[model samples]
Target: MASSAASVLNRLLQNASRPKKPSQPPPSPSLILHHINSNNFAAAFSALFSIPTPLSIPLYSRLLRISASTRSLVDARHLESHIISTHHPRHPPTFLLNRTIETYAACGSLRDARELFDEMPRRNGGTWNAIISAYASAGHSHDAILLFSRMNKSGSSRPNDVSFACALGSCADLLALLLARQIHCLVLKYGFAKNVILSTSVVDVYGKCGIMSDARKVFDEMRERNAVSWNVIVRRYLEMNEGEEAVILFFTMIVDGVRPLNFTVSNALVACSDVSALKEGCQIHGIAVKLGFDGDHVVENSLMEMYAKNGLLEDARKLFDDSTSRDVVSWTSIISGYALCGRFAEAEKLFDSMPERNVVSWNAMLAGYVRCLCWGKALDFIFLMAKESEEMDNVSLKLILNVCAGVSDLELGKQVHGFVFRHGFCSNIFIGNALVDMYGKCGNLRSAELWFLSMASNRDKISWNALISGYTRHGRSEEALNAFGEMQWETTPNEFTCSTALAACANIFVLRHGKQIHAHMIRNDFNMDVIIQGALVDMYCKCRSIEYAINVFEQATSKDIILWNSMIMGCAYNGRGEFGLELFEMMLKDGTKADNVTFIAILLACITEGYVDLGHRYFNLMSDEFGIIPRVEHYECMIELLGKHGFMVELEDFIERMPFEPTTPMWMRIFDCCREHSYARLGERAERWINESNPLNPVEFNVCSGPAMEPS
Candidate 1:
């Protein structure tokens, strides 16, 4: 294609090398004028050379009046008077001047066009139209409109199709829809609506001005329609997000047997991506292949992005691989696909191999790393991006800062905060939210609150959720509830906020407030979420209402393992040992496998209820049946169970065989049992273990047995 264009240019330059006529005689005045006005350039060239004499030459002036093409080929700047002396010496010179200006205007030399227009011996309607169209075509709409108004003020000829088109184009460029309407009315008044070129230009103008309805009205009124007219309307609809309409219009064009152009098909396919119209997108793809436009880069890029965005990664990859000439945008689309599909390693490898990269390339890499949970790597990439002179704008900063929050990196978070302040991006809403989340995730509520208060705008649900959840996770239950109360005044809490606040409620044991929240959930129709319902059940159980917890648990429509665990643990902790055991058995019967925490609660319940036999059964079942390994707390519960039963010899033997050394509390439990049963030999052994292992007194000991302090 490059060589073809160059060859075309070479031929044009070669045609300019013809030898000039030498001492040619001039032709008859009428004959020369006829030759110049003729449309055929070769015929006019021959007639100009047939002149008989040079001294009495009147042909040059006649030639000037003939054709714009002949005058363009001439180098007669010094022979101007001879031509003028013969032709129209007595007539008004406005026609010749207008012709000269129009010639330059058509040749796209706007400066020369303007110069000729200004230096004309006289100005007229044709001259103003020429200059206005020239300015409009050059994207100098203001100059075009100014000259147009001047023509009207001078009472020159009213605008024809050519003049109206220029004026309307200026209105479109400026988005002056009102001015465009006025031009439309004037064009209608002049009965130029039948002119297909004028009508198409007006449709294009209206479409650009966002008045698609008017554009359609003009389009339907046209007696003759061209491919350009169809493309303009289709593009307008696509831009408006009316993808369905765009597709419908495209098929209508096809049904009318109008072959869809590359741009028209591209517009329709691009619209499919916006609405996720997969069927329509496929149809457009099929049409493109049939029309041989599937190979066009623009159409192919849009197809790749469309399929990628619609969760069709494999299909998108297939299209990308099939592409013959992939540009940077092509690579960006495929990389974004891999990132979105959670294939970060592949995305990163492909990004590294790209021959060249742009801003989109950097952003894609950063976003990919963050999405893959590699926050440290994301931050590293951010520094490299800055060194390469890629500006970290608000979107980039927000992505990296969110990664910081996820990783809970306080040092990196603080440095990013400073970067935000220095770069004047502190006020961006997304960046501010990310900052709040970062401090919250790092267990720094003080910093989080400070940043939250500094935000000028009202908080969104994400902001409130982050603040509330931060407090709950850090054991600041009272503050979490207070933030929840404040958030209610600003915005309604969603299920996530309610669940988080319920967690705080369980910690504080504020039964009154918890009941009120439960009532609010019922009133606001938030009782349907299984997670929130489970939270409500847990909150009720923590507040020491076993019956209410059971009621809420029973009413929950979809009970998951979390709900079952919450109920089991609630019963265990609140002294409903029999009920807790029954619930555990029911959970197993219902095929809900209890996890380690659930088994711990079950064993603790057995110890509290003096069910030593049941505790042994579960301990063995935990290891053998469920294949669950016991942690330290599980061991503690077993010791408590044995010590409560006064099984000293068995407890000692069990402790000796343990994987980890027993803590002082485990021996203390045994010591208290010895004191209760008056076993002096066991008490002496406990005392010796305490005195020799650590001279310092243990902070806590069983109340039943302990030596008194020597002095204060």
Candidate 2:
């Protein structure tokens, strides 16, 4: 009895010391829903996994919806796995599974979305729409269209309004007009045309495809128009260069009581800028201010650009200064404004003062300098851009390469080429063209050709033009003509291509090639442009076909200053100086003002005719009357005219009173005239000037001195 009692006590003690199982809490669906509703997804996710009971289909569906709506793809995926693992060969509820698929699609995990979509034993319209929209949104338009067709053929689920919208969007993206038209017909057949969103999509697609009429027709047919509808058509008109139409539409929108959105105002302003309708632009600006959109960055930037384009720099500056918040675009606008107005120093100063600088700002500054012909300053900015660790994009590199070409800085261009290679921008077609052009301009034809050949598959007309122009510029006319011939088989020659090729023909005096190119131009209808006409005139003159040049000139219905100058120079080159002078008078009478080139041409004509008085009158008239500064070439022409007339005393006095010292070549011209007229004393003075100009070239100086040393 005693041992039994001891064993019972020991058993009781052991039982007392042992741990008891704690009561498990029930799953709180309300708590999970609350956390999810409050966007405390982490807490909800944690609460979900802690549930002791098996998750109901409703609960799982709710969680998946929350995940899908919040884009909690990770949690949605996790819950999906749990449902699959727990069900184990028994399918989860269709709603829960579909929500999971939608979540994946929304997260850009189309791969997972597709796998889940295919794995479902049963599918619904929502599931198909989810996957198709995902594909379309990811820029896989072809795949989206293919899947839509497959969905149609399946006949399992009829596509709804959302599906049609997604499919139409895909068609629009692909710019597949035929497919889009079929889809439009489908929309009509399915009676989805009444859906405003679908109708808007149709209009947008047509507009983007450059079918403005079709876009307008679709837009007009909309039973009820929204701001989006108006914006689309207005923007399309601006893009199609129909600025007046865009402005009219904006006024119509206001009359119809549709409030213009920011985009509408911005686009309307862009149209105004395009047409240089300053009054219309200012009206829009006032409307934007009244609408309280002037404070908006995008609208303000557009307004600034419009003002600048209209030459209202002060107004643009005022707008820029008044803005409370400024972005890179704002800075770029103001900089470009100053640049367009030729205030490069101010532009640079503004660029330096910017709180932040981006590639666009840098590019704007570079372009501004280039426009002002500040090549050295542009190059300096490029170097500074490099030092700042800013990755030079294709535009930056292209701009710098152009500056290098402008200044003929080959070493800097080579360095930029190295930068291009290092950054792997060589494969870009524009950069490739720029590189080829730069090399050609720098007198590195071999490298230019190599770069041109390297861009074999990427070569466009621009590439061909750059190469051909480079060759022509460097006097490699044969290569230029050969390149032009090759270009004919590769691509149709543009106006620039034909113009540059004609220039090559002119340089070599190849009338046959010129005629052939001219025939090509006529065949292709490329000769109507004034630029090409000017080229043809110059070409014929160089080929000694003065009559052909004159015929071409007479046929030009409207002649710009360049065309006028080309004709005048052609007459001068062909020794018809008097005719050239007569043409100049005709040019003046035609209301075409004479620029510096015109003056040069007329002066050359005077020199050709040995009209000393006429040359003198025109030279003074150029600066005094027309306000045209006389460049070195003009001075050179004056010297040549005086020397040719054997006016030694006058020539010497003119040289001594000139604003600039006479160059070696000018003195050489004088020396040649002295020899021709037997003016030994003046010839000795001209010899001394030439020798003093080239102190390093003693041998040439001795040779030049021999003539003056001769006793005449």
Candidate 3:
């Protein structure tokens, strides 16, 4: 069969090069058309070229239709060349010439179509639409838009619905919202706004541009809509991460009794997955089954992803096991589920056993390792993936950068940055943000700032967040605040920006900056979420504004454990232990569950207030009631509590009974307490421990446990 195909192709090439006289008189146009209708285009083309008579424009136009239907570039080229050679058209040949252009475009030779279009003696509306549609269909969006604008300026012809639809499609591709609006007004001016096809195109462009308000307005005003219209709006919402809106539209479509398409079900499922709305996802699944689309490949894949992302992994795994139509997407969906759940061992086994792997599948396993925080393993697997040369996409690159940030692997991050540049991914805003985050996290703020500045035009909120968070992480609080200020010039800061900026303010005691950010949030209605409330409390407390901290803490309509913990710790730091203890008791009475962090704050209060007995009781409650393990910080607080009260024997005994070796900070805390109480014996032990633990202990010191004062 291979050899036979080779022989046939050789003959076709030979025929293309040499024109032999038809051994018989040129077949009648009817007979030649019979060959074309039978799809014997080669024979039909040869006979048409051999015709001895000049053809009518109608006959030539009919022949161009057949060639367009064939979608054969070679046949289209031959037909055009033969027509050019015959020079058969008399005057105003635009009708037949327009079809030749359409035929050339349909055959995927826009270059040839364009040249012919430009050479036309005179072009009509049909001629302009044909070329515009050709450019639109070929994905030459900019050129299509340019030509569409030219058509209006040249006044060569008035554009009908078809021409507007083509130009609107180009605007959709480029996300040219302003241009789309202009075309939309023209659509109204030309009295084509009611045409369903043209109306649908306007809706599609508005949706793709992410102007949902306009999209909905147009849709509501539509005298009619098809399934394509419904699908476009829902899909655009999902793409823009407006999942709730997508789901609302999906339900609206159903209530309108528009029979759900397979893709409609798929889009609804995607919305459900994104928002983790499991109930809605299951509803869509049932809809698919009811519509007999349950067996559809796309719906089944969407179901798998939906179930996995919503934490129904067992259901997803069961579906994967029962599915007979497993493709790369099916496998990847299941693997990503396992990764999301932090079950890397199972994810890896399934990934290795899959019959085929694409970049998505590879990224799934790599992401699993990163999500599980197995950084070293993730680093190793990425290197393994490099061996396969799986074309790393932005998702994979971001995951790898995340691993670099996780382990603070600057060298590896630089290598991946090179890979991003080599593959022309640096211009992608998401990847650029990831690069900034990676460099910032690796403690290289200069590189992060440089990258941020370089992408000045494209940077979004996430980009500014990355640089601000990086500065805060490395103790460059002033820089972090400055970046936040500058960010206001380009883009408004969101919760993440405010959170980090507040932290920087807290670090440097910049109460003025913290207050300004708070006012800005109020003005923007940034909706003082729980995280913001917590940061506000910590910031005020750190800046020695206890009254303001208390005011914000009490005014919060709802308080989570983190907010309670922050207020309590702030009180302890500012010598307000009594008030902090009162807040803790109120927290318990409020039925807020205290975790390990809450216990840490309470213990700090105990240490500051010198409540020796209360500190011991809370330490016991950590294990007895809350099942919280007593971490080293809790133990250090206990030592300080005992030493400050001059319970020297108990402090010594407590240190001896500790479950683990004390850290340097613990020894230093014990040393400070013992020096204040003039307890020499314990002070000596702490000095030796500090020296052994951190050989570089640099503070000039002696047993400032000061000479032992005789007991009373």
Candidate 4:
């Protein structure tokens, strides 16, 4: 029965083909629209638009109108099917198929666009233009340029203004200036210089490629302009960090009645923050709010970032709180603001309260902890992330590794090393650099060297800095200097490299080598770096050149807390005890809050001068007013001061009340004092301490009884 039915249909088809007059291709539009409406769009679009050579624009427009209405109903699979049905057969005209592909490209369905591109039967200028624009829009400029070359070779359809414009856009995306100029010449040959869209695209391309003069020439010649034309110049100024120029362009755009988009306001606000024009930022803020763009995420994020950068944390926090829906960036901005303000505990609390956590969130928290010297907790989070198999990105690993280096936890550091090794991240440059730092901080310079050698690539400046710093930290100053010389022979030393080597020179008292590094720093214009300057100051002081140290300290253009500490401590350590005292008092008067290290330096200065009363007063003030409890070093200072004043009885009482066990050095000082003063009663007490410190060295009574030093 089925064979009979097929025979009947074949007979009817044969008779219809033999003597049928042309009937306008059976009104393919109506049939195609029906098929498109009934969800048989693939078959309908293919049949209606399958006239091979020059595709009709009117028919293509009709099909596009229908497709545009059902855009939300289109899925990825439907787009893929359309590309397949149109390109695989020689039926669809190149222009119509290309037009349909443009829709998919605009919708960001590059995968579908590529599928159609690969299947095209007869490619032409329109087809190549469609593919090139898709690739450039999707940020695959290399692919776009490659496709344009293939299209030029085809020579089927001549390149037009759209073709050259699209190709130039690709080159701009790639930042290929040479290629863009070549395409601009092609645009001129096509006489499309008068095309407004093409001209503006050229301006945009040149502006993005940093050829601002050429972009401006093109812009000035344009008799017609649009929003995009203004944005090109505005963004150009913003890129140059010329906030004033960008503001002028924005005003011109607005006065010209070109309605500013959300992106335009966002870019201008970013420029304001770049130049730290806080007043300009606040004015732009009001404009964005009035324009109803304040609630937009991109605008809000930029505003928050602007306020944060300008040190307006309160305003940033208020903007963040005003947002009804806060994303990870919102939380990171506020938390990072706290970190910038030195409110580490508050930053930690905000980090904990965040409902969502991303790598940025973790990085902000880790940086905060590192700043607070809570490196142990920072490392804990790093390990926790590893244990949970969360994405351990290169940045997070580097941050944690730096914290590991700071605290010098060898065991925990080794565990992280094991994780890096297992995860195949050991070869990553950043991870490798951080690993060098971790091993160095753990006091395993050899291990650090091993890791350094294992890196598969040449080391960057950071890698060199880590290794040099490791050697310096381990008291291998000679080796560190050797590495520094080698580094200079191979690569240019950055400020950090010079600073790390200077720190080593300070540690080893290599005054000559340190001076050479200082010379190099000055030559490179890095003498102004506060860290490098501070390090040089410290180096000179450690080498006992207080005059040179003072010169470096005084020459600093700006001073941070570290600079103040370095100068004060250097003065205290280099026999300039009086100067150190004067600097400390000046620092206090200047409103530089004295940290624990500051107090320690000043107290040591007083101890050196035998101003026992003043030392005690500072200690009491640090404890009571500043909330700095005495640590072991502070207690040692008190003990030494008391012993120096011949107060053996009081020194004993002070040592007894210490929160930690007194080291042998602390006890030996008391014993020496007792012996010097001929205090027989205190001598007996000191002897007991020495015996207790060394159980094997038993005290023996002699005809002139005295304490033995040690066992034979």
Best by lDDT: 3
User: Between the candidate structures 2 and 3, which one is better when assessed by TM-score?
Assistant: 3
* Tens digit of per-residue lDDT, candidate 3, span 6-87: 9999999999999877775557888776886797867877888667665677767777777788787877777677676677
Q: lDDT of each structure? A: 0.78, 0.86, 0.88, 0.77
- Could you say which candidate leads in TM-score? 3
Q: Could you list the CA RMSD of all candidates, in the order they appear?
A: 13.9, 5.4, 8.7, 7.9
- Minimal lDDT window, size 10, model 3: 697-706
**Candidate 2 residue-wise lDDT, 324-364, digit = tens:** 88888898998988886778878878988988888888888
Better of 3 and 4 by lDDT: 3
Runs in model 3 deviating more than 4 A are 1-25, 54-66, 82-92, 555-558, 586-592, 661-665, 684-712
Report the error of model 1 at residue 701, Å. Answer: 9.1
Which stretches of model 2 miss by more than 4 angstroms?
A: 1-25, 34-43, 47-62, 82-92, 138-161, 164-226, 233-259, 290-292, 389-391, 488-490, 511-530, 547-560, 588-596, 620-632, 635-712
- Report the C-alpha lDDT of model 4 over 1-712, residue by residue, as the tens digit: 9999999999999998897686664444556567766877567655653433322466455556556455522643443355445554556566766866776776667877788778777777778888888887778888888887777777776777766777787887788888888878878886888888888888888888878889889988988878777877788878866778788777777778887778888888778777888888898898888889988998898898789878898899899888998999889978876875567777778877988888777777677677677766777866676665476677777777778778877887787778788888876898888899889888899998888877735577777888898898889988898989987766788888888898889888999999998888778776467888888888999999999999988887777778888888888787788888898877778787888888878777887778887887888899899888888788778877877776666666676777787777777776766666555565667678788878897553222334533223
Residue 593 displacement (Å), model 3: 3.9
Tell me how candidate 2 scores on lDDT.
0.86
Error of 4 at 191 (Å): 11
Assess every candidate by TM-score. 0.57, 0.81, 0.90, 0.70
Better of 2 and 4 by TM-score: 2
lDDT of 1 by residue, 408-491 (tens): 878988998998999898778778888888899899999999989888465687888888998998999999999989998888
How far in Å is the alpha carbon of 536 misplaced in model 2? 3.5
Candidate 1 Cα misplacement greater than 4 A, ranges? 1-320, 325-344, 358-389, 585-594, 608-611, 621-628, 644-650, 663-694, 698-712
List clash counts for every candidate, in order.
4, 0, 0, 1
Candidate 1: give its CA RMSD in angstroms.
13.9
